[model samples]
Target: MSEPLYHVSANPHVRDNGSTQKIMLDVIIALLPATIFGIYIFGAPAAKTIVITIVTCVAAEYIYQKLMKQPVTISDMSAALTGLLLALNLPPEVPFWLPIIGGVFAIIVVKQLFGGLGQNFMNPALGARCFLLISFAARMSAFTYDGVTTATPLASLKAGESVDVLRMFEGFIPGTIGETSAILLIIGGIYLVARKVISPIIPCVYIATVAVFVTLFGGHGVDIQYIAAHLFGGGLMLGAIFMATDYVTSPITNKGKVIYGIVLGILTGLFRLFGPMAEGVSYSIIIANILVPLIEKVTMPTPFGIVKGGKSNE
Candidate 1:
């Protein structure tokens, strides 16, 4: 009977309620509010950019896997999420081809080439965004609305121009599509935490650290509210909730997570206060991503029946 042609698998007989598909689906849903708000704020150009990015990303992933004779993983929707995130991080006035190039870089260089899902070293979207920022500084820094140029809130702040906090919250600021509305981003972040999709520790610790550091050393003109403004403004919420918490690139151990959050916060604060750029969340998260492996090793949990330097008895 050929041993009944059935085999047993490994232990972990039970599995949790989450799957990659479900988690990715939840993430797509979570991104909706901010995306919709972005379109409303930036109009048709924002919508077109998002669509192009996503299509290019999905197509690129599909074509790459086909050429390599590997099973297509596009059904997982991770590529779509990465594409959308990349688009959201871009300015509305970015050249059309710029997003296509970024999407290809994300789907090919950062993701598929690394063996796909859960194997990427850094968040693909953030990696692509950083690349675009470096390669096209002029386009990346140029903010616009309805074909009219304007200074980003961060740029204004850096240039020592006064800004109205109320307008920033209301999404009148010229910045990246999803970064303009601090209020909307916060609401989405809270939803993700509430749904257990992400840990609150990272967000809380990172934001608090930035707030406190800015308060202490940002300047005599820097007030507590200004620190709060930094927290709620720009891409801080988006990066803390999404990019920093990316499972593949972030620390797994609890202690390591806290440390990662703290370091990310400090770097972000320093960059904003001292660096030329007004925002630092993306850079901070990428820096922390590179340290996750080391952090995990140092903070590894002790195994059962094992001493600090001894082996366990079987």
Candidate 2:
């Protein structure tokens, strides 16, 4: 075929080699270790939560679309991912109906109502997680591990108790379903970075900032265990790696991402140290998601061959 005169077109004239299905599939693979580890730690109840969340989320999306005369797109796996992430953020012992409510809100109100998939302004799972956290603080905060109520390491720290660092690193402690295992979460994060499904800068900066902040101002000053517990004891790893790095909700520019991560890290530190809540990752990520559009706007790169005042830079 011969080249034709340049034709005018709308946006997205070019497409990447990746598809929505392939990207979502990679996310599923990355999340598998943490999801399975969560189930293993929490046992059958955890399994039930996971299955209920996935089914409810997928069904909500399908049914809403069919009723509204829109094409059903649950095959893309976005709803499944949302459900899984929301479940991971929940205490394993929550009522099964909780995930069902969260699933409906996530898909119908958070995702589909905002134009679905790529159009949503915030991370659906984190939004649902925050919603649940607020409305059901009693249930969401009461964590049970091995049939006993336990404060998460962060909460224990706030209560002036020391935690076993090794158990925290492993998956032996109680918290949310997916956030207890720092090792498994790190491995999954590495896989996603290797597969190029996500950039490492966000998680790295977020975690590093938390480490540095706690190390500098942890009151005891420079204690390794103090910093480690703050880093590995809660949802920082899970939120930074999975939810905060969401394509639709996160900044598109590299610089914007770094700044966003820094903001999250600082906000998290403030909340952990001063705020009443023990875990700040969920709140930090949700707040950052809301600011993404503004971050992108400010960090937006100047057009090629264009300079300030509309002059050519070239």
Q: What is candidate 2's local distance difference test score?
A: 0.88
Question: What is the lDDT, from 0 to 100, of the residue 216 in candidate 2?
Answer: 71
lDDT of 2 at 28: 86
Q: Model 2, range 169-260, lDDT digits (tens) per residue?
A: 99799999999999999999999898888889999999999988887766868899989999898999999999888888888789999999
lDDT of each: 0.83, 0.88
Q: Single out the weakest 10-residue window by summed lDDT for candidate 1.
A: 7-16
Question: Cα deviation in Å at residue 253, candidate 2?
Answer: 1.4
Where model 1 places Cα greater than 4 Å from the true spot, the runs are 1-15
lDDT of 1 by residue, 1-314 (tens): 46566666422121468767777777878788888988998888899999999999999999999999998989978899999999999987677999999999999999888888777888999999999999998998888866789877776776777777777776777889887777777787788788788778887788888887888877745675566567767888788877788878888677888999899989998899899889888888888888988998889988888867768855
Estimate TM-scores for all models: 0.92, 0.94
Question: Any runs in candidate 2 off by more than 4 Å, and if so which?
Answer: 1-15, 309-314
The RMSD of every model to the true structure, in order and in angstroms, is: 3.2, 2.6
